[model samples]
Target: MSLLEIEDLRVTFATEAGPVEAVRGVSFSLSRERLGIVGESGSGKTMTGRSVLRLIRAPGRIEARRMSFDGIDLARIPEREMRALRGRRIAMVMQDPKYSLNPVMRVGRQLTEGLRLRDGMSARAARAKALEALEAVQIRDPERVLEAYPHELSGGMGQRVMIAMMLIPEPDLLIADEPTSALDVTVQAEVLRILDGLVRERGMGLMFISHDLNLVSRFCDRVLVMYRGRIVEEIEANRLSQAQHPYTRGLLNCLPTIGGPRQPLPTLTRDAAWLE
Candidate 1:
């Protein structure tokens, strides 16, 4: 069975313009492999990830015909049970660690908080686990990093810490929304390597959401191309260049080539039929 299954998932928000559907009848399944969701900023990639954890706030509503994780019905689970499953069974790594990590809290505290509070690990044990997790992500001087504040770490370092904290629980699935979008090419490669290693070693399903089609094509096994609020096409990562959808083709055309073209990049043309 798939690690995660989502069918006809819809997310909507009430607005002066009436109800706005952010995610329109999306359906997909994930196994113990990397699945990438690629689209523009308003394409509902992030919302789909957040809805899996029932993180949609007031004003925003999530509805689905079915949403399950590991045989458990996520759409029907009580809030308390869902809370218990959130960090221990499923984890998320946001795009920007600066916004995800608490500025006021020390890194060590944030990393160990769920371990101690949710898992009921003792302070010493939690600290040890936190150190181990930090090390797993190739963070040198784990002790020093644990003592530092979120703001004290560089963008790359902060992102690594976020990955560490999320992995500390050893979740069955991870939803990473643009995890390396804020870093340089070198740092991004490092972060991707760490994520790749963890996914392979732990056999965890990963839902990687990103706007970078090239990166997604390289990193993921399967790619779901989202346009507007729906998935317009699904293709093998290696065959992304052969996508038949017009929107997917347009997105691919917009990617700047290394030594190929020096002229102006092509503008993406939109079709209203894509929303239907």
Candidate 2:
């Protein structure tokens, strides 16, 4: 069965002007593979990711014909039940680890918290698992990292810690929202490599949301190009160069060629029809 399925999914916020729809009729299915949702800021990619986890708060609401994970209806489930599903069954890795990690908590404590609570593990077992997870993410010194706080780690280290925390639960699906955006370019690739390896090894479905077209195309199995609250095009990652949608083409064109002659990059031109 598909790991996740959504039909006619919509998200709207109560703005001063009126109810503004952030995601409109977004629909897709995922299995044990990486699926990339690419778009610019305010394109609804992140909102869609959060909505899948039912993370939208008051003043914002989610509506959908159907939203299911492994045949269970997510839209109809109670918040309490949804809480059980989240983190254990479905986890998310955010853009910045500093904001996600607890400021005052020791890294090991935060890392072991979920396993202890959810898996009914003893403190010693949880710590062992946490250390193992950190090792899996390629942390140089898991012992020292466990004792340190979030503020003591570098951006790249923090991000790896976040990924390790998410992986500890062995979730069936992972929603990574711009997870590598804050890291240096070289560090970004290393983080992705670690994440990619884990996802493949675990056979977990992945929802990778980011604005970097080239990165998404190379990393994910399939690509969904979202524009202004809707998916403008869906294509295989390898065939991204042949995307039919003008918006997709425009995004690809904006990427500067590595060895090509130096020239001013082209600006993207949007059509009013795309917002329809």
lDDT of 1 by residue, 114-174 (tens): 9888779999999999999999999999999999999999999999999999998899999
How do all models score by TM-score? 0.97, 0.98
Candidate 1, residue 39: the lDDT equals 97
Model 1 residue 55 CA deviation (Å) reads 0.8
- In model 2, what lDDT does residue 77 have? 94
lDDT of 2 by residue, 25-115 (tens): 9999999999999999999999999998899997999999999999889999998999998898999999999899999999999998887
lDDT of 1 at 253: 92
How many residue pairs collide in each prediction?
0, 0
Q: Which ranges of candidate 1 are over 4 A from the true structure?
A: none
